[model samples]
Target: MTRLQRLVRIAWVFCKYRLDIFLPMAELPAPLKLFFLFAPWHLFPKGSLDRGDRLRLALEELGPVFVKFGQILSTRRDLLPDDMAESLRRLQDNVPPFASATARQIIEDSLGRPVTELFAEFSRDPLASASVAQVHAATMPNGRKVVVKVIRPGIDRVIRQDLALMFMMARLLERYWSEGRRLHPVEVVEDYQTTIYDELDLQREAANASQLRRNFNNSPLIYIPAIDWDHTTKRVLVMERISGIPIADIESLRAAGVDLKVLAEKGVEIFFTQVFRDSFFHADMHPGNIFVDASNPADPRYIAIDFGIVGTLAPDDLSYLARNLLAFFRRDYRQVAELHIQSGWVPPETRVNEFEAAIRTVCEPIFERPLKDISFGHFLLRLFQTARRFNMEVQPQLVLLQKTLLNVEGLGRQLYPELDLWSTAQPYLENWMRKRIGPSGLLRTLQTRLPSWLEQSPEMPQLVHDTLVQLRNAGAPDRGDRQAAITAELAQRHADRRWRLTLGALSLAALAWLGAEEKLVPLAQNMPHYGWALLALAGWLVLKPGRK
Candidate 1:
């Protein structure tokens, strides 16, 4: 169907669902408010429905792109009120599955092979279905069980039409809204475009899964199923079939004798490890995509599915982020405020003290409660609200990370109420911070480059000789005041080189000191009450205390 036809169909669905009744007519725009007085729009159902429900219904009615947009928006609890966020969170892609025959045809066309030849058993019945894709259980010739995921037939057309309409709306919003600059509606739409397009490509999702699997290979915390590459295609993915109780099915997990506390603590540890160690995280970690492998009830491992949406932070972002979290943990609101400005997450002109006060107002109360009791999602929301006061535009990417983190945090807490997230995460972040800013990191860098430097050592003398020859040939004798000038220049160069070498060596020693700190402490303890004399002897050589 055409785009306009689709939009009209959407409007009809909204009306048929009696969505208008849920909205407050008086609070809407003047155009919509006036429309409420007319025929079909005026025939509103009388009930207890709310604005949040109305918004959710309207987006769902608008079809997949709109529904997905709502899903993305639902993650930005920082932007939405509690009720609205709660309502939108229910917008799951539970639409009817496309025909199994059609899915087989798609796989055949994309991979140029018949289904019978590829799999020992290909079930027509869908294992699970969603708007974009559906899966079917199958087995390979080698007797390896796998699940084949196929893209829904004709979805590209549907998605394209809806995305075009979304872009149009975003453009209109940018043109009309007074807060357009701050909102950056066009940029938001652009980001959504990139994300949706990435989702459209199953290969990208497969690669993401592969990378995540590699990151946690043989780890006991999380399990990402292996991708069956030989049977996989662009439109069809064949992956290891996973069996676990759904995370949402709390009763099943409880009945299976799972240790909720250990499970919850593991969840927290996994998140920190992904963020700090891997730097790549699964951004779409909703309960539906999470499952619990309770085979080992004492130590439950999480099974993660749906790799279509993931997020990674730049190194600089990760560094700044570590500091940001540490600052928040320390209750140094001013430093947090300054960091935001320095990192350019917030505009530079924002007053540090004022921002600090605003942040303190938002965060100080949360500290009154235990860290587990404090909702990371809610805290982020309040922080964004405070940021909005200072005209700080939101980072669309960070919103996804924040949303996924909140889901993980919420799920963990629900499983184990006693889980102290702060306590579990604090040490991880602290260790990461120390490595990033301390001596061990410097030593690692030096060690990584040392082999290459050794390989190039033979070329250094020749390089120096060539440099001196070029300088001399340029005009050594003809230059006026040449000798004296060259002498002065050499003195300056020598001083500069001396300082550079000093700083470099100091950094190396600092890293070594950090590495040896624990070992050195014991050695110092055993130093026969004369450690001061040893230090004095070493200091005299390095510092030349006799030289003024």
Candidate 2:
């Protein structure tokens, strides 16, 4: 569709669903507010649907791009109201499949082979369909069952068109709305744009699947399908077909004698393992992307698919996040606040005690409820809200982590309503912390680095000697001072050389010390103070004059 036509359709959808009711009309421009007042949709009888439902419906009707947007928005429970977020969470990617002939054409064109030559049997009908791609079941000549995923035709153009509109809207919101600047609507849209565009590349998704499969190879908690790279292309992906009951089919699970409680606990375990142990997690883990292998009902295994999005944390972030979870479990709000500052998640200048109190205010009440009743997702939401008060800049990297956590929690609750997420996750966090920060962890780290340390050991003495020489020369006087006029030039040149040497030595030393700090005590409480002192000393030395 033309851009103008798309905009008109979007406007019609918005009015038809009366989505303006969700907006702060009072905060909008006077002209826009007046336009809303005279909108034709106002003529229709008000339905029983709530604002959230109306918004969700509008997005769904707007097409796959808007649906995807809603799905992403659903994850930001901290930023959205419970009802709105919950409603958006229900947004599913079940767009109508394109013609099978078109899918075949794309596959053949991308793979450089006809379907008959590529597979022993190929189904024209799609096994599943989504916004960006659709999957068709097929069998190889070797009789190996597989699925061929084809990207939607002209999806790139469609996405670009939709994204332009989104950007325009985001700019408008940031320009006119009071909360827009704080929310960073433009940045959010940009992030989404990057993510969706990445999704268009089937090769990247296949690689994600391959890495995850390797990470969980021989593991019983979850299963990832193997990629058929020989047939995979940027437009088409071929992978081993997997068959399992959809995770959302609770009735089927029960009928298959699956243990719901065990399933729920295992889900929590899998999530923590992905986040803390493997450090690579499938980010798009909604019910649709998950399934249950109930062959061994007592020990049900999860089957994961759709690896278009994944998340990882930097080492420091990983350590701090683990400590934060552990501290929260122990009800040590002070430590939580400290970790946030230490990890640079919150502004450095934030008052720890005040932040601690804010966290306690948000978290303590949640603890009053039974462990089984508390929702980790809601707790995180509250925590995010409290952190915002301290002007905590959102960590874009952790956005996927937060979203995955919410999905895991929701899946757990769905399987077993009385699931104690804390109990399931606490021991795992504690164990992870112990292995990461305890004596054993330290020994392992030392062992890993011992060879490198030894290799560099020979240079240490020379480094020390060079640093001392620089320090000594920085204070040395020019013996040519007897020749007064030339002495000044000689002294300046000498001072410059000495200054360069000293700064270089200091930099090397600082780097060495920082490396040691990382290996020795990654989450050390006093390391920041030591770092500040070093920085202060460097500043003084830089500003200090040489021998005059």
Candidate 3:
């Protein structure tokens, strides 16, 4: 269908199901409200469903990309209203598969081999169907059982069109919504586009799967199925077939006598291991993409599928995120606030004390309960809500991480309610932190780069001599223009440093305010007061020096 026709079809589906009813009647513009009331027959047909249900239906009808978007939004209870978040959480990945003949054609064309030649058996029926691709059971000629995943035919055109609409909606949102600027709807959509479109290429997904599999090479906690490189192509992937109970099929898992608690705790470990140890995580970790092997009931193993969407944090982002998470757990609101500024996630000019106080208000209540009792998802939501008050812009990269975390947390909770996420994650993070920053990390880096260093050492003397000569010539007073340029650069750098310091101070103040709520040790409480008084005392110290 043409992009326009697809949009029209979506609109018609919404109208037929009365999706507008879910929207707040009073909050909408007067004209839109009036139009909804007066043009019910034209905009919404009779016997319509609940507005939330209708919206879900319309998105599903639209296509996989839109449905995937809905799934991502569901994780952001922080950004969305309660009703919408709840409704969107119901967006399932199960969609009708393309014809078996179509799947055959895609595989044959991509691999340049007939199905009969490639596989001993290729099932006509799909094992499962999702928005991005469908899986069909097959056996390699070598007698290895595998699953062939074929990208849905014509999905790219649909995704591009839906993405265009998403951008348009994002622009409208930024123009109209009160929270648009803070929420950064357009950036969020753009991030989603990059993520979903990347999933369209089976080659990329296969590589991601291979890397993750290698990371956990001999690990018992998680299993990533081997990719059949010989049969894999840009549009078609052949992977080792795995047999396990779906992670969400609790009844079946229970019937198979899987150790639920071990399974749950292991899930948390697997996530931390992937993110902190491997620095690569499977971002799309919805229940459908996860399974559990109950073969060894005492030691349950997690089986992961759908490696299409994954995320990695930048070094700076990883450091700041770790500090923020640690600070929040310790109820050190000031540290959290300072970290945000230091990380540049929030504007540097924000007052640290005020931000700190806001964070304390949002987090203290949650801390009153045990980590097991606290809802990690709700905690994030509240944190974001508090951040919005301080003009904090949403971090699009963190959005995927947050969504995946929520899914993992939810799955863990369902399997084991008493699971202490803080306890489970803290040790892993601490170990990672130590290895990342301490002597061990330096040693590891040295070891890894030793060969290259040895290879380049022979040329180092000449390189250093040449560099020193350039520096000496550049510093020569005969070059007055060079001196002037150097001076100007230094001055600009100084100004930038001052601005950064101011931002640092502001962030610190926000953190102090947030951390002050807990009965701080008397000394810590007096520190801020002392710091303030020292500013006043600085003039006297300077005057004394001047008089002397």
Give per-model TM-scores.
0.81, 0.81, 0.79
Please count the clashing residue pairs in each candidate, in the order shown. 2, 0, 11
Whose TM-score is higher: candidate 1's or candidate 3's?
1
lDDT of 2 by residue, 1-548 (tens): 89999999998887788776666677888998898888887876668999889889888899998999899988876567889998998887898999999998998999899989999999978989999999999999999999999999999999999999999988988887777777788888887998898899999999999999998898889999999999999999999999999999999999999999999998999899888988999999989899999999999999999999888888788888888888998999999999999888888999999999999999888999898899898889888988988887767788899999988999999999999999988898888988897656655675465445444543544565555455545665853344543444455546555654565464555446556667535634555785556545555555555444
Q: Which ten residues in a row have the lowest lDDT in candidate 3?
A: 539-548
lDDT of 3 by residue, 1-548 (tens): 88778778777766776665544455568887788787644644546455566677777776678889988877776577767787888988778888999999999999898999999999989999988899999998889999999999988888888889889978877766677777888988888888888888899999999999999998998999999898898899999999999999989988988889999999999888878777799998888889988999889999999999898988778888887888887889999999988887789999999999999999998999877898877788888877877888878768878888998999999888898888888877877888787655654564465445434533544454455446656777665566655654555444444433543454344445445645235545565674545433432322322111
Report the C-alpha lDDT of model 1 over 1-548, residue by residue, as the tens digit: 88778878866766765665534444557886676667474355634668788788778767677888888878766456779888998997777878888988998898888989888999989989877789899998889999999988788898888778778867766665566668787887787778887887888889999999999999999999999777667788989999999988889999999999998888888888888898899888888899999999999999999899989888788888888888988999989999899889899999999999999999999999988787776787788878987988868757667877788888888888777777787789999989977666765665466445434533544465456556665756655656756654565454444443554465448445855676556655675654456344334333442211
Lowest lDDT block of 10, candidate 1: 539-548
Give the total clashing residue pairs for model 1.
Answer: 2
* Model 3 stretches with alpha carbons more than 4 Å out: 17-51, 445-548
Query: Best lDDT goes to which candidate?
Result: 2
RMSD of 1: 8.1
Candidate 3 Cα deviation (angstroms), residue 232: 0.8
lDDT of each: 0.78, 0.84, 0.80
Candidate 3 positional error at 441, Å: 2.4
Whole-model lDDT, candidate 2? 0.84
